[model samples]
Target: MRRLFPALLAVAAALAAAFLLLPLVALFARVSPGTLVVRAGQGAFRDALVVSLKTSLIAHAIVLGVGTPAAYLLATRRFRGRSLLVGVLELPLVLPPAVAGISLLAAFGANGLLGGTLDALGLRIPFTQAAVVLAVVFVASPFYLRAAIAAFEAVDPRLLEASRTLGAGPGRTFARVALPLAAGGLAAGSSLAWARGLGEFGATLMFAGSLRGVTQTLPLAIYAELNVDYPVALAIGALLVLVSVAVLLVIRLVPSWTRFASIWPTASAASSSR
Candidate 1:
């Protein structure tokens, strides 16, 4: 009975893997390499690729810069409402992308709460490149933030205490010790955030209006091309899938690499001592 159960589980796992991979294989089969190469030279494709790269990179920078400190604070401190605050930050992780767009609009759109003030100051966010960046950040930052918090929490407290006892300040200890120790996790989180930012569509479309050359990222461009240029859309979709797969590979491999590297040194030292 036990042997039969294991065989059944293996079959189920294989079926699940096939289910996930078949669509990707079909997508690739439908796209011609020659067409992809030709379309890659087109101005619209180039512009969308550039826009996606620019906005996603900037959004990732924002996530890393802001999320790191925020995570460190959450990991190191305990205060009233801390859990509530974390829940609020993580809300967007589970929130529908369309809802996130609407929320951004409500806060920053014309006639919104802060919108009038921004209008008076001659600052506008909606339907612009900045809006695309904002949308990406809103939907993607939480992934990095949550991972960062966990990474910081995993660090050995004794190392931090020792750093402090050696007269290092909080800032120094964090920069010198904590950051290095948590680098792998942080990289994984950043890659995930970048991938999310790259694939962001609904929030960007609703908030940024998909203006060509200004706000039309890869996903938006794919939508725009579906009716007018199906082949180009397929090419772009294939490119996006490739990028996404690369990011997923990094996210999956980084933690394992870090764990093995961490363990190897400890094992070696123990063996030498024996």
Candidate 2:
């Protein structure tokens, strides 16, 4: 019975692997690599590719810059309504993509919550390239923020205390000690957020309007090309798959980043010498 159970589990695992991998295999099989390169380099595909890379990278930078501090705060502090705040921050993770789009529009759309204020400032957000960035940030940041909070929380509290004892301020401790120790988890989170932003579709379509060269990203390009040029759509999908695989590879290497934790003691020594 034990042997039979193991064999059944193996069969199920194989099935799951096939279920996940076969579609990707089919997508790449549909087009030759040379054709994919040609299509991806020409016409609207090129424009969409450029826009996606630009906006997704920008969104990732914004998340890392802003969300890191925010995550650190939430992870290190115990305060009133912290749980509520965390819940609100993570809400986007569960939100439907269409709903996420609508949420952005409600917050930044002309006639939205801040619409009048933004217009008064001469900044229109919806249906522009900036709107694509906003949409990506809105949807992708939660992934990073969630991961970052867990990473920061995972740091050794004793190291932080030791840094303080060594005359390091809170900022110095965070920058020199906590940040290094958490690098592995942060990299993992960053990869997930970047990939999520790269594949963003529904919210961007809703908020950015899919204008070629302005707001159209690769996913939108894929949709636009599906009926008009099936081959081009497949090519774009293959490109996305390639990028996703690269992100996964980065995630696979995150354990190596744990080696950065060794820097914490070095930081404490520097602080002691000061």
Candidate 3:
């Protein structure tokens, strides 16, 4: 029975691995290099790629800029409703894609809560490229914020005190000490946020209307092509698979790289002393 238990566990693990990998394997196998090359040159693929890259990058920048400080505050402070605020921010992470889209519409749509204010300002959001960016930010910022908070929380409070004792202010200590210690986590979180933004679909489609060269991202392009141009969809899926693999690899390696970087100066100093 003991031997059988280990064997059963191995079989289950193998099955899980196979189950996860089979779809990716089939996708890559179906997408030939020629098909990818051909699709890459096509207007639909090119335009969607450009839009996806542009919107996702812009969204990533926004998330990092706004989310980092917000995350730091949430991690360091003990304020009223802090937990509630975090839960609200993280709500999008688990919300159904369709629900997320509707939530955005309810908040920003023509007759939504902010609609009259936006109208007074003559600012249109729905069915535009800006809407796509907003949707991406709405869904993706939480990933970064969650990760950044965790990263910030992991920093040594003593190190923070030491910096303060050394005459550093809050901003200086965070910028010089806390941020460097948390770089690996920040990178991993930023990559995840960027990937999430890149792959945003339902929310973007609902808000941005999927117009090619305007708001159609790669995932949206894949959806638009799935029925009419299956081969192109396959190519885009392959591209996403590749990008996802690279992101996962980076997430896995970043900690090791950070550790090595942290130790290198110490090792060099020891060698010089010897």
Best by lDDT: 2
> For candidate 1, what's the RMSD?
2.5
> What overall lDDT, based on C-alpha atoms, would model 2 receive against the true structure?
0.92
Off by over 4 Å in 3: 1-3, 263-274
Summarize candidate 2's per-residue lDDT along 94-155 as a digit string, tens digits. 99999999989999999899999999999999999899999999999999999999999989
The collision pairs in model 2 are none
* Candidate with maximal TM-score: 3
Model 2: lowest-lDDT 10 consecutive positions: 255-264
Instruction: Write down the lDDT of every candidate, Cα atoms only.
Output: 0.90, 0.92, 0.91
- Residue 6, candidate 1: alpha-carbon lDDT: 91
Shift of residue 235 alpha carbon in model 1, Å: 0.8
Q: Using TM-score as the measure, name the better of candidate 1 and candidate 3.
A: 3
Residues 1-274, candidate 1: write the lDDT tens digits: 7699999999999999999999889879988778777887787788899899899988888888899999999988899999999999999989999998998999999977789999999999999989999999999999999999988988888889999999999999999999988888888989998998999999999999888899999999999998998878889999999899899999999978987777426546879999
lDDT of 1 at 217: 97
